[model samples]
Target: MGTATHDGAESTAGDEELVVSANARFFRALGDPTRIAIIQLLLARPHTVSELINELDVPQSRVSNHLACLRWCRFVETERKGRQVLYSISDPRIRDLLHLATRMAGDNLEHLAASQRTGPDWL
Candidate 1:
């Protein structure tokens, strides 16, 4: 009975490790700029890889690479239609994050411009 209990504890530990590793990978995938752009574009609507390539104005290889990362992270989902895959954000939290990022960017830009007008030396 003790041996069985020990094995169960070890199994639980292993499951936790897997969960943490998966979470780490997900955040690491989101750290890329191209991946963030791809996610933001997808928030509007689903699009084929070719559409993303044109919209992002990036190379096909780069877009495809980022899409793969997003898919792995489970932040985006893909649907198969013949040879093409349509991609879109799978999580609503991503849309909230995008809005928050936009607001932060606008606020930062305004602060930067205001500081520049006042001159850094004056402060």
Candidate 2:
């Protein structure tokens, strides 16, 4: 028993509603381009904050902020190597997930780029 929202998207009822909410939060965490780039880099190999800053060519604060969100969402994990901390994807399945999303987004590039419902501001 789900009800349609104003946007015509079905809102789950009962226990499933909690799951749907969680799924939204998870996707929101990954919705960021910076975060996606960080994940892509980590998929190749772990890197320290400084290294990420250098590679991403973004401000240290920005990279750290995104890393914090990714860490909070359990999308990433960190390990201390002496004085340096290495950040990496927490699970191997993330590679598959990113690959699938890449394909789907590529296939819908035209539609995705034109959609006003989910614009650049959504990020």
Candidate 3:
């Protein structure tokens, strides 16, 4: 029936909108410099909170807070090694995502810098 087809189309459209919104949120999570740095470190290997603090030269609280955010986003996973909690990238594809993003940013650095609509100072 026409009504059934219309309902199905509406449902599909709604699903697509949800997907787009989720994708945007995912990127927003990576928009933070600290979160991005956390991911970059995890890509190499797992690290403990203390190690991250030492490597990043940030306070323990700052490292822990960002680690929590990364965990909530499912961007990284954790493991227990004796008394230490080690964090690592949740998926291999994340490495590819970071690599591609880096290349894209490099290619568009000029445009991104010139854009007044959005940038580090936009907010």
Candidate 4:
């Protein structure tokens, strides 16, 4: 009985560790604006690293770094076609999250603008 209880506790701890690790990786990957942009672009279609560099208009190194982080987080995947590597979002849920975030941002911006126009105390 003691051994069974110990094993169950260990199993629970392992499951919690896995969940926390996954959550940490996801938030860490999303902590960058550039990375978020990359994910958004990839949500549309796969692209080579060079295409990402051009589209995001950022430094090549920065784009590459973000791509690496995203891949580690399991939010994106890579494929090889000839000498070129393509990157794309691995899950459709990421695209949905991006869309939701965009909508929320837009609503927040509009609310801010309205508040400014009416003054903060204007109820």
Q: Give per-candidate clash totals.
A: 0, 0, 0, 0
Cα lDDT, all candidates:
0.80, 0.91, 0.83, 0.80
Off by over 4 Å in 2: 1-13, 110-115, 120-123
Comparing 2 and 3 on lDDT, the stronger one: 2
Q: TM-score for model 1?
A: 0.64
Q: How good is model 4 by TM-score? A: 0.69
Residue-level lDDT of model 2, residues 1-123, one tens digit each, is: 788877787776764678788999999898778999999999999999999999999999999999999999999999999999999999989899988887989878788757878755764
**Which parts of model 3 have CA positions greater than 4 angstroms off?**
1-11, 110-116, 119-123
**Which of 1 and 2 is the better model by TM-score?**
2
- Regions of model 4 farther than 4 Å from truth: 1-14, 103-106, 109-123
Best by TM-score: 2
Q: Model 1 over residues 32-106: C-alpha lDDT tens digits?
A: 668988988898899999999999999999998888878877888999999988998899898887687678778
Residue-level lDDT of model 4, residues 1-123, one tens digit each, is: 212344465345666678699886676668677998898888879999999999999999999888888887888999999999999989889878877767877858666544544432552
lDDT measured at residue 66 in model 3 versus the true structure, 0 to 100: 87
The residue pairs found clashing in candidate 1 are none
